[model samples]
Target: MDNFLETQLHPAEICVVCTEPFSLSHQPVALPCKHIFGHECIKKWLKSGQGNSSACPTCRYVVVEKRTPRVDFDTSSIWKALCDQPPERLNSLMMAIWPGLKILWQRHPSGNFSITEILDQAVIPALIKTARRTESPQDRSYDPVLDCYNLVAASWDSLGRPDTATGLAIAFVRLARLMSTASATLPKWLTSTARTNRLLWRANASLGIFELDVSWDFIIEATNLEEEQYFPLLHLYTVLVSQSIAHNSQPTPWPTRRHDIMNLVVERCCTKIGGTFWKGKPSNKFKDVLVAVYEELRRYQLEKGKMSLRGHDGEERVVKGIWALAGWTAKKVEVR
Candidate 1:
């Protein structure tokens, strides 16, 4: 059976799971039914089944191997072969290599270093080259870049490396800029902009960067404020308030301009909530998020002395009004 299978299959045959030609990374493993598949594909297939029972994709024969066979081959030669593929096949080769790249990254001790190498060596260059080569808005090649970025971001977050995450976020902004120059329309630009902002907001908040102005600019460009619903507004308020507290606590004296930005963010939050309240139709979620933001602000003010003395009276008045609008007394909103 092994001889027959070997005679029937060629090294150049494609893997059924990845749909790419078999190479060192995707060596074929034969089943009892004489069906051949990539080793990784069959391993995943068996693992996804119940109690080690699985069927072959081609012949539906019950797979009985206790373990998938492993084959050792020269990765360098395989990579060289892939690199030698024609230009049109580059995307497919990239897709084929992605799983192995991810596996290599996961096995590394330092996720930060692994992700950095992946981005610097493979993902970024491929994305930039692909973007430059393809001018059509309808091209699907760019999807891989977004996917790879998300994967890296998620991995970095899981590894608690917000510094690296922030770096990747900045790289995404650069990628977005490149995409913008490629005649990207509003929707495409906005998609990239929103993704960049989301990553930046989370990373910056974690790192206490607190650059609210830049974050707000990205938010405004990505979303239409008037047409936005609750969650977007909620995200904006949360980022603004959290970063305000962070900025206030920095060693450098808090800038008066930052106080104004905080005030502006608060005012916008109140205006939105007030509109809903006046209509006798306030969203509980919106109010809850606003209340959380207010609570955080109040906590910062009490813990870090006064956040602002320049607008002491005016800030007090605005806080009082916002509390009143929310139907909350001073006691109800005190920091615990």
Candidate 2:
């Protein structure tokens, strides 16, 4: 009953990180694994790298797969051996190695390109090259890079420097679309994801949510166009709504309310940055720091309330309460 009430009060949509009950007032974040933690929890997780190779803890479902370099034999020796052998005798080796050559040609990084270029030119091509030859049917289309990209984008979007993060995300969306329509078939060794078509759509959808949070102008402009990537654009709308709630916790100081602060610090994040930040997610650190401050702030607020009754020590208490609310609210909405 307690758990039920907590979820009810908070709404199932809110973050589940801080052991706090869900709140109707908090922000809700959708993760790549299709699991929901608190916005704060997910944000911090994305920043810290915990989400990099993570799976859905509840189901042990893989969210993102790691990419490692493929091992290559000394082709110099193979070439020397092949020089004396007829082309017909070397058919097996040529068949075995040709795919690697194709992947290398496609992904080589040599020039400036969009996020699409980074993934197609370097990341996805690398994965394709590394995959085991016998892993799956040649028609299988599962690409883990999309999930990895989403996690990276999510981490960066929340932490700051949204421009860089946005670039990364846009690249994936573009590539996913391009691949969807291209005449070429997905190579074997990629898993079959026909059953997860919607999730693929959802993953793409999630990107737009963050984009929306970053700018309404982009959303408005996107809506007016005949665009095929609807998921990212709709996601932007969702992100804007979530951000509005999360950001509304503190009242602007009177002077600053009237005027913007010149010294304000702003950090944009991608999902990967948030998942495995310098150490852990910002949510985790933010919670620990806020909890300490909250203890003091709550005590000060109480002391001020008490002092106000006695006409002493009132101002400091009120100031502390004001300062503590942002952290408190963050704690309230964040899940672990």
Candidate 3:
């Protein structure tokens, strides 16, 4: 009953097109606008009216589907050779092969690439094979796998493709899980749990819920304020809050209240920087840091309200929340 109530409180998953439940036969298909519908219904709708005028039934946004041809590459020898080698040799092989892969991807006829195919066919299998060779946790080296995944992620990001990056990050997480199960321990350098969580946070920044929550759990587990990693944690927290606000336009149900979230961040920042941060006279250094955070929060809020920036109550609330977090009054901090 509690589970049922929770489901009721949250948005229910249903196909908008056919007004039916999404199942295997009536699978949910996402349009460019991020709205989803029954696969068959969307296909029929696209075929209806002027075929060229096919648009998302929900948002009426024109849907342009880019199809790519599946290219089969014979990477059997490369995989076998890499699996048999040590981490050093594996790294050398990856460095040599990555350039060629990039060139091939660029020269592909379709231009539209699929990261899933690349990872599944080559990268993941190689990583698993290599992992299986190590008898003990200490003997296993994650550098090669981590380096390869990072390279792929960088390539996707450079190509202005977050979607592909997200897929690659997810693939890395799966690879890490596989390795952990095989070795019974995750590598220190890779920090598999925390790193994967961070990747998940990055990958789903646009529409993260479960990923964001899980990322936070790992982050808190991995670091405390006394460490240097605390700064990165702060940045991650800011990003998550900013993204959540922009995406939802209202208080997120998970966090419950926006002010509560900001207060927690503020408390942590104060503890890390110094006890004097929010006390007596605020130091220039502390103020400078707070200003930077405030500016970023303000920028994201404005971007979210780009359609109509005037008299936006939600934006005002966010602005006020940021100011309160820094122990400053609204009048003391000029938003404009």
User: lDDT per residue, candidate 2, 142-197, as tens digits?
Assistant: 33332343344455546662334343344343334322311022223221223122
Which lDDT values do the candidates have, in the order given? 0.41, 0.35, 0.42
> What lDDT is obtained when candidate 3 is compared to the true structure?
0.42
In the range 217-329, model 1's lDDT, one tens digit per residue, is 33322222232322233343333344344343343443245345344544544442222212233344344435544554656566767442111223433433343444443
Supply candidate 2's per-residue lDDT for 212: 17
Worst 10 residues of 3 by lDDT: 178-187
Candidate 2 worst ten-residue window by lDDT:
258-267
lDDT of 2 at 135: 33
TM-score of each: 0.22, 0.20, 0.22
What is the per-residue lDDT of model 3 for residues 1-336, given as tens digits with 9 covering 90 to 100?
A: 998887766452787777889877888877778788888888777755444436787677877442233232112322233345554554443333333334434555332334444454444444444333454332344344444444454665576743343433443433322222211112223322333334222322322221211233333322233333333333433433443333334334434454564454444333322222112433443444454454456465677672322212244344344534544432244442
**After superposition, which runs of candidate 2 have C-alpha atoms over 4 Å from their true positions?**
1-117, 120-122, 125-218, 221-232, 244-251, 254-336
User: Considering lDDT, which of the candidate structures 2 and 3 is the better prediction for this target?
Assistant: 3
lDDT of 2: 0.35
> Could you tell me how far off, in angstroms, the CA of residue 198 lies in candidate 3 after the best superposition?
8.9
- Sort the predicted structures by lDDT, highest score first: 3, 1, 2
